[model samples]
Structures are given as C-alpha cells and as structure tokens.
Target: MTDSNVSFLGRISLAVGTFFSILGDGEFAARVQRLRSGAPVTQAPVAAPAPTPAPQPAAPALKQASPDAALQLLGLLQRDARFIDFVEEDVAGYSDADIGAAARVVHGGCRTVLREHFTIRPVREEAEGSRVTLPEGFDATAVRLTGNVVGKAPFTGSLSHRGWRVDDVRLPKLAASHDASVIAAAEVEL
Candidate 1:
C-alpha cells in the first residue's frame, strides 16, 4: 500500500501474499506485471472500474430459437446418417466388432452430413494441448471454461479441445406443407 522501501524479507512476504492475490485477481496480476516491468504502481490495490468495459455490449442475448431449424437438422441427420435408426436400435446383443463396424459407417455419414450442411471450424486457432491465454471479456459461450475454473479471466491453461463453431448453416428450405416432425418416413415397399 506504501511506496516506502521494503526489506528483502518483506519483499518475499509480499511475493507470497501477492502470488495468491495474482491468481485470484486479474487486475492485481496486471498491476504486479506493470511494477515488475518498471511501470508506475498505483497506490490502491482495488482495481478501478475499466471505462472501456462499461460500454461492452452485454453478453450476447440467447435468441428465441425456432424448432423448425432443429427439426430440419434432425431430418437431414436421419436421411444422411440414419442417425435416428442407429440411436434407436437395440444393440445390447451385438458384439463389439459388429458395433464398431456399424459405428464406423454411421460416423462417416454423420461427418459427411455435417461437412455438407455446415461451415464448421474450431473456436480457437491454437492446436489442442497448446498453451493459451484467455483474455478478460472472452465470450463465455465460445470458450467454455473447464476443470478448476476459479478466479477472474486472463486464464492460462492447456487447450483441452479446439471446440467447434458453426460458421455457416446451409440447410435446404422445406415447403410450408412439409411436416418436419417426420424425421424419416417409414418405408412401404410395393
């Protein structure tokens, strides 16, 4: 709190106390970094409200989702991947080898459907397992914090997964009369 010179022991004590503080408080960590780099230290330990953040648009609003798109997606999945069939099937008696083979086919079809209909990409550019730092005000929805997510942002950790983001969707337009509820029509062979 004071600019008065601290003794060697006192500096160590400060380091130990502030190390915990830095972990819990991003602003404190930033100030510590500034001091370490010979920048002027503010007397107040409490971080002043950042004015720029005051105008930060509120966390993106959760839009009122239409079920039509969801149903359409399901229909596409059923058509391409037989996803519904795979999920609904009673595979309890199937051997692991058989299930694996079936899964391989399903996986390929599902992948194909996703690739065709959606322009998908990883949320982060960095490779998984790479060290990354999430700056303050990072979109919470985009970068889901996992495993011991404590304290303020400016989080530094290994990238567990480069999470997917749907850049674009290209679902086919359906007729107004078409019933989206029927994901897959029952077959009636003549």
Candidate 2:
C-alpha cells in the first residue's frame, strides 16, 4: 500500500498547502530543496543543479495510492456540506455575503468531518510568534524551515505556523460491494 499513516485526503491537503508555501516562502522552498537532495537538516545549502535545455518527466515509482478513501471522504463532505456543489459553482457573480455564508457551511462541515475522522495535533509545542530554537538535526518532515533560513541548525526563529500532524485516522471500513468512484450518487425527488 502506498498509504502511509496519513489518509489520501490528508496527503492531498498537505500537497496543495505545501505548493502555496513553497511559492510564497523562499525559506520553505529552500528547506524542501535540501530535504529533496537528502541533505542534513542543519547542513549549509547546496547549489542548484544546472538546468538542461530539454527536461523529461519522471514516472512515479512508488506503490499506488488507493482512491477509495479519497472518494469516501469526498462523499462525506458532499453529503454533509454540499462541498462539490459549492466548489463547482461559479462564484464570480455572487456577493461577498452570499459567499461567506456558503463558506461558513462548508467550513463547519469540513471541520466536523476532520475532527471526527482524524486525531490531528500541532507539530510544535511553542506558541506561534514565540522565539524557539531548533537544535542540530530537527525532524525536517515535521518542522519545515521557512523565512530567512541560513547556515546550520541551532536555528532560532519566530513561529509563523505551528503546523499540523495527523496522529490517527478513523475512517470507516469499506463494504464489499462499495463503489469507490461514486463520490456521491444522484438523488431525485419521487
């Protein structure tokens, strides 16, 4: 199973959020680069590889992630919050108040599903904006370095985000006849 302890939905969320973090935060991007190259967390940065005129796409080599959990989670969200509808809607024509109201509904339902299905906790113990120092060899996966990162570790910085980790997942088991692809079945009034 390509599945680690994290659920498919959790990984998806992480990937999307990380994409934005990498783009806006140079320090976060640097840390990701270092980790990708198998460098130690405290090590000085490495020079970027020379770009080739033509680059080829690399095929994924790891075990495949099953879509069952992701579909199930989406079904839950759709059932609870009409999530698919909300996202699919063309909101450019809507007023701010209308959007805010819909967002509240989505947020509440999503929050409920997450809390019920996943035991999530902060990666750091220190309060955000507090000065905290990471000694040599901090867990790179858990705590990503961001903003003005330099030299070795024993690095001190203010916490911008505490970060979240899924401690446990409690998604219900799939039935023998379950169709994972159908995130939500169409309903009609009789």
Candidate 3:
C-alpha cells in the first residue's frame, strides 16, 4: 500500500477505535486492536443467538360503578336546591348585584341540601393561611403541593385551603318508577 493509503487507513482505524470506546464495546475494541496490529480477523462458525423475550405481567381487572347512582345524586340536588338551574343559567347580561342576590338564594338552598344529605368536614384541621408541615409519607390525594416541589418531605407551607371531605352520605332511596336521568321536570301552566 502507498504511504498516503496506509496513513488514511490508520486514521479510519483510530476513528473506529474512539467510536467503539465511547459506546463501551469491549469486543469491538479488541477486534479494532487486532486489525490495527495486522492480525487475521476470523469469525467463529456459530451464528448469533436470538434474544430472549421478556415476561409480561397479567393486567388487573377494573371495577366500574353504576352511572345510575351518580345520576340519582344529581337529580336529588336539582330537586332540593335547583342546583342545575343556577349553574346552567347565563349570567353575562345580569348585573353583579342581581347575580349576587340569585347566588345567595342558590347558596342557601344548596347548603341546606348538603347539610341534610351529606356529612362533610375539612380534610386538614389547620386554619387556611396558617403555616403547616406535611410529614413524610403524607396522603398525596388529600394534600397537593404546589410551587418548587423537590426532595422528600416534611414540606412546610401555608395552608391555602382546608379541603373538604365527605364523612357520610345519606341520599334517600329512589322509587322503582323514578327515572334518575331526569334532573328536573318541565312545568307547563294551562
């Protein structure tokens, strides 16, 4: 081989060595070393073995609750508080005072319904805006941490809200004839 050809080949070999070294390919590095030293490159007769497949875990079955129960709850709220009507109403045209007046009535009715049907209490005993420490292994579902959340807790932060939790539910049983899907019945005067 010419001097220029040998030099070019050496440079290519050095480049391949560097690439294989970076990839941590020890076997490839050995082969490259042998090639650079003008040693004969021989392949073994045996073919490469096929990769083994990884074992897959069986998926757990999911439990689904009846939508009728949720519909029944919504129907009861509408009946007792007119909750659906107030929420569905457009308030863009109404003045702030008018809206506030309507909201007061809605709020009173809704509060009455909630008091009668469901027992609710705050999730955290601490007053809102009070500094509190959430110890390690805290319930993630009950308290959500916001802003620069890093490392393991006890996280110290001001309580933005004392979150509500339903301690007990006492919804009345629906009659067999009653349709839960009907949130509110339409009234017509003759």
Model 1's alpha-carbon lDDT is 0.81
Give the RMSD in angstroms, all C-alphas superposed, for model 3: 23.2
lDDT of 2 at 115: 91
TM-score of each: 0.66, 0.69, 0.63
Cα lDDT, model 3, residue 57: 31
TM-score of candidate 3 against the unseen true structure:
0.63
Residue ranges of candidate 2 with Cα displaced over 4 Å: 1-63
Pick out the ten consecutive residues of candidate 3 with the lowest summed lDDT. 49-58
Tens digits of lDDT, candidate 3, 80-106: 778788777767789999989988888
**Candidates ranked, most accurate by lDDT first:** 2, 1, 3
The candidate that achieves the highest lDDT relative to the unseen native structure? 2
Worst 10 residues of 2 by lDDT: 49-58
